[model samples]
Target: MIKEQGEGKSRYMPGLDGLRAISVLAVIAYHMNVSWAPGGLLGVAVFFTLSGYLITDQLVAQWQTAKRIDFAGFWMRRIRRLMPAMFVMLAVVGAWLLLFDPERLASLQGDFVSVSLYFNNWWLIFHQVSYFESFGPPSPLGHLWSIAIEEQFYLIWPILLTVLLRFTKQRGKLMMFILLGAAASTVAMAMIYVPGSDPSRVYYGTDTRAFALLIGAALAVAWPSRSLSAAISDKSRLVFDILGGAGLLAIVWLIWKTNEYDSLLYNGGLALFSVLTAVVTAVLAHPASRVAKAMGCRPLRWIGVRSYSLYLWHFPVIILMNPSGIADDVHAGRALVQIALSLLLAALSWTCIEEPIRRGFRSPFREKIQGWSPFQYRNKRAVSALALMLFLISGYSSLNADRPADPSPAIIDTSSNGQEGTTLPVTDPGIPAVVIPEAPIPMEPQPKSEESSKPATNAGITAIGDSVLLDAAPHLEKLLPGIMIDGKVGRQMYQALDVVDQLKAEGKLGDRIVIELGTNGAFSSKQLRELLSSLQDARKIVLINTRVPRKWQDTVNSTLEEVANEYANTEIMDWYSASKNKQTYFADDGVHLKREGAESYAFLLSKTLQGG
Candidate 1:
């Protein structure tokens, strides 16, 4: 162990900041395009590790030197370090929501309150939030979800450590056991449950994420003495440097090759690889190691130093500047411009907002005030205000609820009652049957006993499609009265299928399955075939041929026609014909249906079902 002569000052580790820079950049790039960088989100795993190591190290050192941990002082320092910048960022994000999108303003308000109160992760988990979902990219503070996780860990880990130290006087072995147990449990859980579970739950659960942080904490607690560190010769250091580089490169490569479907496996692998790299890097932390010096480069270290601000700023910029309706447009030039803007904004926030507040909290005046009794310092007042804000936000969200429409709709067929044979609706109108088949014999009406089950008045409609299908739900429900209509919206058809299966299991699958997918999945014949296969159970499946705003009409129409031909149950709703060569149904957010268009679509859909 390196001895410190001073009371407050601590030795700075080399290359840690550079590693942070790499992680943050990977996250930004991954969010920008998961296709380009599959495992980019692993940056958060790296961050958790770094945070665990540093925070544990600080707390353990303080306990060792002082012989007693000053819990109040320790908590105060944490609040001062984390809260001010976080609150300021939340305030900014809140202001942005108010000015930009009023429809999503309620959710933003709720998220802001949760983030400020250090419960964003819990809120997100309960709500089943996914950062990549099409609820229009989340606020800039979406990144704060990880921060919430870390803070929550800090709350528990310290108390556990303090207790362990008080009793055992040996921290290293205890930490190792805890870390090993956590890692084993996490891996086991992921293997057994995550593969077959809801992606949202798997992505956001705290237990699923704890292993990454525990690994770092364990390393910090079990750090070897300087004598052991010195025993690592130049050859060993060189070998470690090579291994670390390979590990880092492998992580980046894996990210580019993976997708959201593979998140559990990718994250598990990355965490293990990262822990190994961290261990190797720690062993080679000497001044003579070129890898350490490279990782401590001036520019990279500078970016790493302000990584928190960059992480906070990047998502909001990408979300807010997104084109009206396109979810994933690969406009390299536009993205580059956005990236530049994000960097500028991050720099300004880091210098003008975060640094000033952080420095202020560390100043002599603030220290003197902090030394006062807890009540005199007014920390309770701040806590009370935060509580009130959270209450207000929750109340607001509850009051402004956008209740989902009934999932079932009454099926109307006036032409057929108890008939024998009926001509089923088919794509080829010329081959109309001469006889109309009778509806299935009505079950004998049992005496209306009190225990008798009521007839289903509304069988729910499942609208499976891209983002546009989501936007059409309200209009659809309005047009098809007494029937429940809900949308399973996603960027990929496979995601839509997943939701469809869930709805079926929940008994929300209606008599009619309406499909308006194809915008994104149209390019892939395999996806279209898969979607058709998934909808095989539906009594009636309606396919809306793609309509274009302008340039992509030909491409979208071609894809739609191909899909229509491949399925027997499919009937193409002529959206292309209805639009009359102009974009009618879509909103400025090109992928979502406009109100007028959705109403038109609902009318057409109702007519098609009624005619059948």
Candidate 2:
């Protein structure tokens, strides 16, 4: 710990700032859809752990010195530090929306309200929105949820810590209490989390995520001293070195190997990541640790100092600069421009807005004119004029354009009167006059081979999947007589295992099986192997791959291909390849099918079933 004097605080750790830099960069890379950082979103857990440690350390120091906590002052400090930059970003985004895309205003308005109130996570949960699921354009303010969690902790924790300090002088008891809370939160997460499904309920819940924060607080309670006597002994140093090395390796492994879709993530992955990060944090907190010195390099410290502003501005900049949606393939040139602009904005915000506000400068309205360097002041004036001109043009275009349309998700609608046909409509805000064709008439009975013509053919074939399978059910039934499709919205493969077992017990496990379960989320290779064993009695098995534009797409597809190659009874449908160029066949969500897509999909399956 470097005891640099800053505003009367004795403890300063530049290496911690380097950690912040790493965390925010990982998150930015993940949001950019960079292939190398699949688990980059875990950066949020790092931030959470850091927050817990820093905030707890401060509270404990205040208690030890002043023997009392200044709750009101602490709250005001946090609000002053965070809210000003947040409001600036929101105002800029709101103006951009009003000028260029008023259609998003309604949703943005709701998001702004929730964020301002520090309840954005609950609002997202209420709307059943999953952070990992990219269905449309990315929301600029989507990252605010983490800030909300931090603020929530800031609001409630000081009071709780004060009470604990007043009640018990024993640090051990307090640590025990915190451990209990962590245990409860972890259990709650494990209970609510469902593998291979939308994880919004657990991911966004404060109760479920509090464990990461608690882990940090526990470490703060046990933080080692920098004094020579308290310096790590040779044996203890070896232990720290091993734990630190293992923790760093684990984090790097997870970043490369895991993604949001992995089931292990829900089971225990996040908590494990937090624990490992805590171990690294302990090593970094000690000044004698060689790893700490390496992480405290000048560049990492500089980025760490500006990390907050970078995080606040990067996502909005990415969204605004991206003409194509976030989930689409990114142009390298555009991505580079986005990164450069985001960094520039962060630097400007740091110098012009954040520092001045923190230093109690005159109103920002006045500083806009006088506080900047002469070069910056002139550039700011020119930029302001240009912005005004563009805003007017955008406003005129928005007004003269047709009223904005609300985008609706595509849904399957089976025809009435017990028909075996499905039609899907793909809706977009633009092209209001776009018409979707009705379902194709059922296919006439095709000539059957000796094997296909067998009686009691209802027992010959069955298909199980999620809504993607539901979209193709009617077409499949029409093309292949007496085919059974058991598809439910949001169905997971684990649930499908039970369905298959029930079918087998009823003596209805068909001679052939088609499983299309990975669209919603990813399953482990072990799960896939178990599912295949359940269907081993079938003469032929079909695994339909997914083309959903989510992090899990490749994992699901690759797993299917690998398992299929190893099993003589199985083959993959290659839907990802078939659907690659057929963009018009998909809805705006880029997963479910339109009518023509369903027809193409059914035809492919029909041919594959016939050994084509």
Candidate 3:
């Protein structure tokens, strides 16, 4: 979407603004967890390419015309344009967390500092935090990592371009250097990426992700569109048409084909998508291109022009609007409200902060008077009032929200005979109607002689599990007293073997053992079989199946049932069945338990143990 101009410079292209609209919308849809846009995070790659093209276009023009770059002016403009709105967002979020969600404040303290310093990606990587994994509640500012990457690019790229220009004026050599940088970045990403593990490190690394930006730069140097467009014939125009359409379709197809779980994405899929985006950009850059005209429609261009503000505001707005997070009731109405509010905030930020700052405010009163057309003024005031009312309503609703009273479950160590921490009664909805047994099941006494004895007492019960198990540990202990519970966050099935061995060595291994693994990741039939072998020494083993919204849920449940059937000492606790339609019992993830869900989970386990 390059504008046709002479004098060694490109003018503003409306179609490029439209492309920004598409990219920002994709990112917003992804963050909203829309089912259709599973690969919407690819929007970041689009932004990287666009940033590369625009910045290089400006720098190349300066190098060719002025024979030097205005480094101070360029850095100042970037800081003024991007930092003000970002600072406002961070400040608002910090206040919100302090006022409404104090628990998340400590975790986000580092986020604030890192994001402010433009190295948040490295901070997350150093902490070994996966972007996809939520250890607790997610930070609203998590998306700032991409901004950090762009800022880092801005920091180093202009000086590098100046050096390149000083060394040689040949665009061919410049293009080669950019290509080599892109290639090296791609190789670095592939080298560090491990299949089947979290790809956060590769995804967040600046050295790895710089390829997308470099690829865009390479495209600019290789195909300066004003020159290429004049050389094209009618037959070549047809080729451009096909290439443009094909490139767009390829992006949509890849978005549908790949998901966060796809291992190939880190290996080469991202690089492929970036290349495809560059191709589409090249097509749009041509002045005679019809695809550019089509995408340059007014509505898309409007969104594109204000995209930076929208991107900055949309994520926090979504997070704040969801009073209960993924657990809260979600409908089209709430979604509409979220979209409207995001747009309003973006429009306000553009008018109030970005535009005025960009103009340098020679005289605020005269500018405000000049800017105030009757209709525009009324519309701005009306939207501001609406936004204020909505914020107040949101604050009231959040303040009076009926959150579960029980704190998150404490981590328990398997090395000792540890009882669970204190648990309060679930306060969301009253306890569901549970058929409590006439009395707690009486423990049978153990036989001193070699003869067979009745099944071991409830005192000889031990439970091992992941975060879900941790959520229910206190309730499980309260329901089945004296039971030893060992649970931790993000525990996987293979880790269970080690836990079992540890329990056995400590002589705390129980006859009736509850295994609540497989919530974090999928395990194979072979792994299940091996785990079953480890538990064979127990009198009876209970396998708790999962209800997570992940792709592996059915495989995990079926594998557990199949293995439980093969072993007479094993039985399945069908948590998936019991938790169906009981959305109030769980958090947004549908895997971890809230207070109501934790209580229900404990009741289900207790009932299963008591022959319910």
Instruction: Give the clashing pairs for model 3.
Output: 1-284, 1-285, 585-597
TM-score of 3: 0.75
Candidate order by TM-score, decreasing, is: 2, 3, 1
lDDT of 2 by residue, 246-271 (tens): 77677777876778777666677788
Instruction: Report the alpha-carbon TM-score of model 2 versus the true structure.
Output: 0.82
What TM-score, to 2 decimals, does candidate 1 have?
0.62
lDDT of 2 at 108: 76
Comparing 1 with 2 on TM-score, the higher-scoring candidate is 2
Candidate 3, residues 1-612, lDDT tens digits: the string is 333223247765666777788888888877777767768788889999988877787777767778888888778878887899889778777877677667556657899999999999999888766675442335678888999999999999999988988996788988999889998999999999754445678889999999999999888777664454536688878888799889888877666555665666777778878889999988877776778788778788767878898998887777666654431233466677788878877777777667667667653522442222222544776766677567546844753574546534322211111112233122122233212222112222334456345333467788888667877877876677667777665566756777788878988788888889877655656667887898888888889999875444665787788888999899999989988999788764456777999998999888877777
Q: Which ten residues in a row have the lowest lDDT in candidate 2?
A: 412-421
Prediction 3 global C-alpha lDDT: 0.72
Model 1: per-residue lDDT, tens digit, 1-612?
A: 121222122455457777788888988887676356656777887788777766666666777778666666666666765676667656655665565445566746778788887888888867555554332334556667888888888788778767767776566667767677567746754664433123545555577677777777777677622213445677877776777677667666766664454434534664575576457446434444566678878777777777887887777666555543222545587577567766755555555455546565354322332111122234544643553343334323432342223211111111211113343221112233223224222111232356246543334455655445555656555555445544322334445566577767977677677766544322345555676787787777777776533222444466557877877777778876876634445543344456677777778877886664
